[model samples]
Target: MRERLFAAAERVLAREGAAGLTNRAVTEEAGLAKGLLYSHFADLDDFVAQLVLDRFEAIAAEVAGLPERAGSGEVRENLTGAALALLGTNGPAVAAAALSRSAVAERVRQAWEGGAPGPGAVEEAMARYVEAEQRLGRMAAEVDGAMLALAITGTVHHLRMHGSALPDDNPELVRRLVAALVTVP
Candidate 1:
């Protein structure tokens, strides 16, 4: 039920942007009673924050497997895959929703700061993956895994936050960034 609400919210966000996202809109989109949303969430702000954090948690979970992928596929491909996976979700819309409401934004920030799964979690997984790749002699020995992780994840965050910069080519930009950082050899 919660997942349905989240999905409905995403669709609402996609079609109407954050301005059109209301408890009624979400509930109607989900084909459920309008009161159902209030029953599950405190309000629209709570719902929006949870939706954003849910996306972050999902991406973190997906990227968490990066280290396990080390020593397998091309290093560039692996890194690019991890980077693109972050963008593959409806990150920009979710971010826009959070940014549209200050309270929602603050709640999401506090949750992230509290060590709830967020960008930092993805960064850590990336660092571990890079370290694993380095161990396998796929990445440069002198490269700083943590720093590389920061670079990639930071760019991803920026792109998601300001999605209009490269509207049609975020994945390409991520791929290029990963390529510039790590050599295939």
Candidate 2:
């Protein structure tokens, strides 16, 4: 039921943008009783917050596996794959919904404050992966894993914010950035 609601919300968000999202719209899109939303969430803000959080959590989970892939592939390729997986999702729409609504933004802020992982989790995952590679002598010993993680995630966030307005060449750019960061002396 939660997946149904989330999918419905995603559809509404994708087709109508944040401004067009409403409990009624989500319910209708989900083809469920309106009361189901209220039963599952405290309000539209909560729903929106959960929607975005769910996506981030999935990304985080995927990233959490990066350390295991450390020496299995090219560092640049692996990092690029992770970055692209994040950007290829409905992240832009979820981000827009959270940012456009103050209540939603507050909910998200509260979640983050309450120990829910945000972009920081992704950065940390990337840092762990980089550290693993450095241990294997694949990355520069002098490189700061955390800093490189921040740069990659920051660029991903920037690209996601611009959405379709930006050209579709960001994957290559991210690849190059990762390559530069992992380059050994």
Candidate 3:
């Protein structure tokens, strides 16, 4: 039921904009009793906060494939693949939630500023790729993978925020940006 509620929230957010979000609407959409929401969450603010966190966990899961690459050209493919996936799904939601929910805004700030755990998905992916590149002597020893990760993630998030004019469901820009940012030099 709790999962249903969050799923409903995501559907509403994707379809009707964050301003249209409401507990009653979510419960109606979820086909669950109204009390289910209050039973699972203290209030809308708590639900929104959990939703924000859930989105990050979703992105992390989507990109979890990056770390398992073990063949030629795998590193670049993994990084770019993860970046594209990240932008395609959770990217827009994160941006929308930031504008619609203050808790999301605060969490995004903390995560972006390195206050969150483990330097985030982009950072973790970048670090893996950089280590691989360094092993192959494709990158300089001084390259800061964490900084590049932050930049790439920030760019993707910002682009998604203002990306209404772009081709719907196209992640070409995100792929290009991640490629450029993580390129060996």
Candidate 4:
């Protein structure tokens, strides 16, 4: 049910943008009763907050599996894949949500305070993958894993914020960025 609501929210966000993301719009998009949202969430802010967190959690799970790829794949390839995944299904929607006023932002802050992983989890996942590569001698000893992770995620975030206005070239751009950062040999 939550997944259904989240998908509905995504549709509404994509079609209506953040300003149009009312509970009515989400319920209409989901084909569910309007009351269903309040029953599951305290308000629209809570719903939006949960939607953003759910997306981040999904990305975090993907990142959490990066260590298993440590020695099996090229480090650059692995990192590029991870960077691409950061832009997941909800990237544009999440970026739109970020522009909303206090309600949604406050709920997100509260969720973070209550231990939701949030954006930092993506960076940490990339850092862990880099550390794994370093341990396997796939990355240079002098490379800063955390800094590299930040650069990748930060660039992805910037591109995501630009959203459909730009061509779909971010994946290749990220791939090249990762290749530049790692030593394949």
Number of the top lDDT candidate? 1
In the predicted model 3, the residue pairs found to clash are none
Question: Which run of 10 residues does model 3 get worst, by summed lDDT?
Answer: 110-119
RMSD of each: 1.3, 1.9, 3.3, 1.8
lDDT of 1 by residue, 42-102 (tens): 9889989998888888888988999999999788888888887787567788788899999
For residues 77-150, write the lDDT of model 2, one tens digit per residue: 88888887676566787788889999888988888788786788888888999899999988888889998888
lDDT of 4 by residue, 1-185 (tens): 99998998888888788888888888889999988999999988888888887887788888878877889866778888888888875687666776585787777778777878766788888898888888988878788989999998887877766664553666777787777766655
Once model 3 is optimally superposed onto the true structure by TM-score, how far is the C-alpha of residue 15 displaced, in angstroms? Answer: 0.9
For each candidate in the order shown, give its overall lDDT on alpha carbons.
Answer: 0.87, 0.83, 0.67, 0.80
RMSD of 3: 3.3
Whole-model alpha-carbon lDDT for candidate 2: 0.83
Where model 2 places Cα greater than 4 Å from the true spot, the runs are 164-173, 176-185
- The residue pairs that clash in candidate 2, if any, are none
Best by TM-score: 1
Query: What is the Cα-based TM-score of model 3?
Result: 0.78
Is candidate 1 or 2 superior in TM-score? Answer: 1
> Once superposed on the true structure, which residue ranges of model 3 sit more than 4 Å away at CA?
61-65, 68-73, 88-90, 107-119, 138-143, 167-170, 182-185
Estimate TM-scores for all models: 0.95, 0.90, 0.78, 0.90
- Residue 148 deviation, candidate 2, in Å? 0.6
Q: How does candidate 3 score on lDDT?
A: 0.67
Q: Write the per-residue lDDT of candidate 3 for residues 1-185, one digit (tens) a residue.
A: 76788889888877777787888888989998877899988878778767766666666776655545534564556667766655666456545756677765675566656644222765577667666666667766677866766787677656656564654644777667766765555
